[model samples]
Target: AQSVTQLDSQVPVFEEAPVELRCNYSSSVSVYLFWYVQYPNQGLQLLLKYLSGSTLVKGINGFEAEFNKSQTSFHLRKPSVHISDTAEYFCAVSPTARQLTFGSGTQLTVLP
Candidate 1:
């Protein structure tokens, strides 16, 4: 089984500012990492994933994440954020891509 930890539960950022949502994971076996965002009254949307190959993975809405094996981290980052980017961000890990263990979730509030 794998587990994820989101460093921040709530993150408030001004519009157009760079932001980083920290995520770390622990697993006995190899795992795939993912970042999902949920808007108000919406389902979880895949933001980015780190399955293999590249250490730096980019996703929709100008979001990206780097997989650090040494640190056991896959932190999500956005150079500039918009008001629409305000949502709940979740970090998930799957050992077999079948079952996922999700973090508590990080509320990204983009302020004006």
Candidate 2:
């Protein structure tokens, strides 16, 4: 079984400022990590994923994340955030294709 933790429940950042959303996972076996973003009144969208290969994975909306196996962390980073980037971000881990674990979610609010 696997579980995920999103360190911050809410993150407020000024527009165009760099922002990072921390995520950590715990599992006995290897798992696939994913980041999903949900805009207001919209469904969740895939932001980034770490399945295999390069530890550094880039996703849509100019967001990226680095997977650290030893630390069991997959933290999302954005060099500059825009007001449109405001959304609810979720960190998910899947031990298998059928089973997925999700974090509490982090609400990122970009201020003008």
lDDT of every model, 2 decimals: 0.96, 0.96
TM-score of each: 0.98, 0.97
Candidate 1 local lDDT, residue 100:
86
Put down candidate 1 lDDT per residue, 1-112, tens digits, no spaces: 7889999999999999999999999999999999999999999999999999989999999999999999999999999999999999999999975898999999999999
What lDDT is reached at residue 110 by model 1?
A: 96
Candidate 2 regions exceeding 4 Å error are none
Model 1 vs truth, CA RMSD: 0.7
Clashing pairs for model 1 are: none
The stretch of ten residues in a row with the least summed lDDT in candidate 2 is 93-102
Model 2: per-residue Cα lDDT over 1-112, one tens digit each: 7899999999999999999999999998889999999999999899989999999999999999999999999999999999999999999999875787999999999999
RMSD of 2: 0.7
